[model samples]
Target: MNCPLISLKAGAVIFTVLWTAWMMWWSGAYSTANLVILAVCGAAVGYVWYRAMRWQFERMGMLPHKDDRSAQ
Candidate 1:
């Protein structure tokens, strides 16, 4: 639902899918291995983002934005 880790994972998956598709369409050098690498990188970014946001929210005593779902 509204879990930071889950949101991060979903964001990573979405980023990987979009990036993989873009690479396949625009770059002839793209490969399955490269896609996998990008996906991994995306996952890492998402994880870092999630952790940072969680820390910020906890420190601030607030969610990112209670009324702004788009921020997440």
Candidate 2:
């Protein structure tokens, strides 16, 4: 149950990081600045998605309950 969701999340995180790196290199020029910028942007999006998914799951009672809002 939860394992599938956890696995999906893990897959998404790794996929985002790897895809960002690959896309950076695949586009040619190989600029460090470009890679860094894109990586940071990708990371931010991934984090937002992760948080949103977790929040929804928590609301649905699919995840353990906790007062995580104050931490944010």
Off by over 4 Å in 2: 1-9, 18-29, 67-72
lDDT of 2 at 1: 39
The local distance difference test score of each candidate is: 0.64, 0.75
**Clashes by residue pair, model 1:** none
> Over the stretch 11-63, how does candidate 2's per-residue lDDT look in tens digits?
66986787787778777866778878888878887777777877787888876
Task: Note the clash tally of each candidate.
Answer: 0, 0
Candidate 1 vs. true structure, TM-score: 0.50
For residue 16, give model 2's deviation from the true position in Å: 2.5
What stretches of model 1 exceed 4 Å from their correct place? 1-29, 63-72
